[model samples]
Target: MLQWKEFEAWVCIEGEETVEYDVQTSEDDRTVTCWIASELGKKFSIHWKNKAFLQDVGGSVKVDGNPCGGTISYAWRDLGRTISKSGIADAATLKSFVFSSLEVTDDDDALISSSSSALQDLGLLELTIYPVRINGELESTVFSRLNLSDLKVHERSKKAVTQQIKLAEPQPLEKAPRVLDIERTGPEVVKFCFKYRPIDVLRANGIAPSPSRLKRKASAEPPRALTPDDLEELADLEEAKNLREKLRALEKKLHKRDKKPRIKDEDGDVIDLTQNGARNKRVKVESDRPFISGEVIDLT
Candidate 1:
């Protein structure tokens, strides 16, 4: 929002995006002029003057070959008197002692400039200049008793309503059930398991009850312990005994290699024992010695 003290009046001429003018007034009832040019080589002239109070004053303006209407008014105060014009509503007020207006002019090649002079002198003070555009034309008029207080009252009422709404409390939201609170007793679990399987079809397919199937049948039972002869037979199996011994030896060899093994090959290749070395050492080979013949290397 912009402050009122900083506000300046603006005019949109023929819906143009650029090209705006600032309006100013002279302290005394003297002629003031401004010139503007359009892109099409057409020009305009604006003129204004100060008046004593709410009274009628006339000036002349020419747009191309067309004539425009103009007027002026004034407002008096202790500091100075305010002078205004209705061509573009540019107004200014200052001390009576320092008031002057010289012949104003602009020489932009494409712009048209016209002279504005007061037709008659009047004793009016405190004036507002209003310029009306009728049918794409400008006409000037003076106004009295203009007040903007109603706008301020409406704004205050809106702000109060907005503050009241903001101070009100918000409503609570509904909550959803928690996962752990859902019931899961024994019978419910059994029923859920039954829902997952077709009981009649499973029985027809020779699937016995879980408890009965878990129990061992006497005739098909395995021996509880090995007999003496069975133990001796296991001991006599030389391949099994050799495998056990080889596994124990491998365990011991790996332990020793981990602690202190050669880190390089005979050819100076860096031996990575943790990865590549283990895989490379697992290659099978048939030894000529009968004692170590058909031995399988277990790198893992």
Candidate 2:
């Protein structure tokens, strides 16, 4: 989250809070920048909140240099969102944020400057918030839909990003009223930018970790104490692991013992020649039991 005084903002993908890396804030604390991973076909949203609403505040959102809409809230408000898409007052459609891959082209002429202007701000989701005061009553106005396909350019212009915002299936949005007369109350404005790239690109740039790497999140709560039952269960599990180790060791020994060869000698005794440590190992066999010429006997 990007926070300035009581105002804060962040981006959410499919209702999930993504990991933000390389977070940097200006010395004046008015501007913040961070990196996030964007997967293709995933939907995302921008959210902002103000804890201490002492004055009327307004915000504007832009995705990939495309201005979505301006949000004007009444005094002493808490939360708001960037208008991704809008419809006429009588229509029933809303806009959603989706990550989409750019279609590459092989046009040599357009490759040089095809997407220069578009890709410059292609991966940025910026929000600007500032104090505002209005003079006239609010009027209802509809947002114009933006067609992304019409902005296609050569793939070389994509820079470090290959994906752009893709609108999902139309959803419903709350009715909004536009402020007719509004002016900034302060000279300074707070800005937050969420820069995105593909997951592999982020990992290669050391902005994100490799897949399935060991990771831990920071938690405010302390570790919980272990109960007596929990300790007992842990002890039992350890004992079981030790027993399995011992059983494996014994089985290994038995297998080695069975692999040795043994045979009876000329006398009524069993001679074991498999033992390399001993010069000649002999076992006493029953004199009454007659042994065959090639009969084998175990001395171990």
Candidate 3:
């Protein structure tokens, strides 16, 4: 919601107050601007409320810089309440306000496709309020002439336009709304501007914060506390690893023992002499005779 003096305005989606971002006011506080996220094919509306004052006040609204067909006049008796421009009167019917995505195509006239009004003010909703006096004439509702196809531009000229205000299906209205004749007495006392775009576009432009996941992925999450079960499982894994290390050490020792050179004693007992010590027996043999281990021959 945006407010100045006693007037307040907001954008609505499906009758609920839509979120606004980057709300700002000029130094004088007469002009207020904000960014709003739009979803394609979603219904939306403009809403406002004013305070009770001694004099009557009125205003005009522009959706995408074109006058939206509705009157904003409030006397002392008609203040302090919220009002919404849910839809527009289209020839005795009502067309719901909608947010729609723009389609960009490769037009054959790509070389000379002129920028249309639809592209200039693609996604803005504004309200200008001022002091007014009741006149004796009647005002007419200006139906929006923004056709969805009118927004389709050449691919080369698509620029940054992604969404715009479009009308939804027209429903039957038994009677159209009444029009009031009111004239502005002075310049607009306050102005509210809402620039709307898709959520992706907003994130791209840094107007709204990126989705929570983009910032709060698990890599950034705080370390979780370990439970008793978690500690027990970790302890069991460490014990298993220690047991494997001991087994490897034992196997390595056995392997070393088997690789050592061995000899036999005269009593036919196997002996190992790979390591030398005082008690190690040295067997004398004639190199001229071919001898093999683990074999004995009988002398005739």
Colliding pairs, model 3: none
lDDT of 2 at 173: 51
Candidate 2 wrongly placed segments (more than 4 Å): 79-91, 112-115, 137-142, 145-149, 173-181, 212-300
Per-residue CA lDDT of model 1 for 45-137, tens digit only, reads: 222233222223222222211222232222222112322222221122111110111122233332221221111110001112332222232
The digit string of per-residue lDDT tens for model 2 on 191-293 reads 9889999878998988877765655656889999999999999999999999999999999999987876666655755555665733555444455577779
Error of 1 at 7 (Å): 15
Tell me which of candidates 1 and 2 scores higher on lDDT: 2
Model 3 per-residue lDDT tens digits across residues 214-299: 56556667899999999999999999999999999999999987886656666666666655551457564435567679667431
lDDT for 171 (candidate 3): 91
lDDT, candidates in the order shown: 0.27, 0.70, 0.73
The top-ranked prediction according to TM-score is 3
